[model samples]
Target: MTDSGEKESAESMLAEIEKKITDAFEIFDHEANKTVDVREIGTIVRSLGCCPSEGELHDMLAEIEEEEPTGYIRFEKFLPMMTHVLMERRYKPSPEDQLLRAFEVLDQDKKGCLSQEEITKYMTEEGEPFTQEEMDEFLSAAVDPDRGVVLYKDYVSLMAIEET
Candidate 1:
């Protein structure tokens, strides 16, 4: 296929995945007695840059063995399911694990307390080739250090706070 054709194919797949995810979210929300408007679903799909079809979305949710008890979707279940859809094979760490991982990312120097510059630089490094604006928007302040940089202890503490 031509480069343009390949790009279009990829975009189409992404849209399909996003649609599936949104559909699953809607199904879960409906079961929860909540109404999921197209606007909200569209926002999620657009944010992720992908959409899944109805069948694919349900397949993704099948592992949970849940169906809308009230014949409608619930946000509670939908939220977790949506999270899974987005994360895919990425590790879903426990709270402690998440904190530790965040600490590892911020503590690039192996010394504690990540400086603002360190945090920014480390994030940029992780997402190589990302625009500055992308880095700014996605980088979490949870790892931002005070004074020199965030101490390892401080970074972990910040992560803990966010988890709670």
Candidate 2:
């Protein structure tokens, strides 16, 4: 693409991202404050399919606050964070790293493996709750029956196989 063409594409992408951020803030800003709170930030990030660690979330909120020091995130502060996340997602980690990160989010107890109950609860909590059949199928495919838990390695391997 020519320089002008590239610039236009970049502008178009930015505009689309801005629209999406606006729509997301509207839905997740529970207090109608026109700013996104910390809790809302977590929900928004998860809804976007990224599982950031607690520390990472805190850092993101802090980074946003550095400019304005508001407890909540206005669009100007929110845009850069959203852009960073979008870039990270576009250049995703390896499948193993992705699975490990996901497992860390799901393993609420830090047990290094996910219990069936934990998986079910986490999946259900996401806006579109998983059905019993879907959960069962996932367990059958991802869980280790002997251990009765979903190990990170096993889950990663299962996903790798599925992609083939």
Candidate 3:
């Protein structure tokens, strides 16, 4: 494609993405007043599959002040906040439920933990098996060596803390 053609393509794609973000925002703007309750902002963003960390959400919220005493975010503020997030490819963490469900599948015994051997087998034999070094790095933080197991729920919580 020509340079001009590629530029147009990029512009159109951005326009389409903005349109979708507007549509999602409108879902919460039930009154059609171009604003939505401040509290619903996080839910709306998450519903659109954006996984912004809590700090990022706070920053976004800080950028937009509510116009009324009741607290709301005007669509004008929401659009660009969401646009930058999407365009920059930010906020891609998997939801907690997803992480838990994946661990649940591997914890066949439903004991809320996985043995070291089980973790090693899955991490080494499963999809995109980790290299010995990678596995070592992963396990160093993911396991409780004294207990010889990983309480996945605790580990996931720990990861969530560190991720932000």
Could you give candidate 3's per-residue lDDT for residues 5-55 as a string of tens digits? 899998998998799889888888989999999888888887666766657
What is the overall TM-score of model 2 with all chains considered together? 0.53
The model with the greater lDDT, 2 or 3, is 3
Scored by TM-score, the top model is: 3
Clashing pairs in 3: none
lDDT, model 1, position 38: 32
What is the alpha-carbon RMSD of candidate 1 to the true structure? Answer: 15.1
Off by over 4 Å in 1: 1-91, 94-109, 127-140, 143-148, 160-164
lDDT (C-alpha, whole model) for all candidates: 0.52, 0.71, 0.82
Model 2 lDDT at residue 94: 49
Per model, state how many residue pairs clash.
Answer: 30, 0, 0
What lDDT, from 0 to 1, does candidate 3 have?
A: 0.82
Error of 3 at 57 (Å): 1.2
The stretch of ten residues in a row with the least summed lDDT in candidate 3 is: 155-164
Task: List the candidate numbers ranked by TM-score, top first.
Answer: 3, 2, 1
lDDT of 1 by residue, 123-146 (tens): 567644445865565354443433
lDDT for 81 (candidate 3): 79
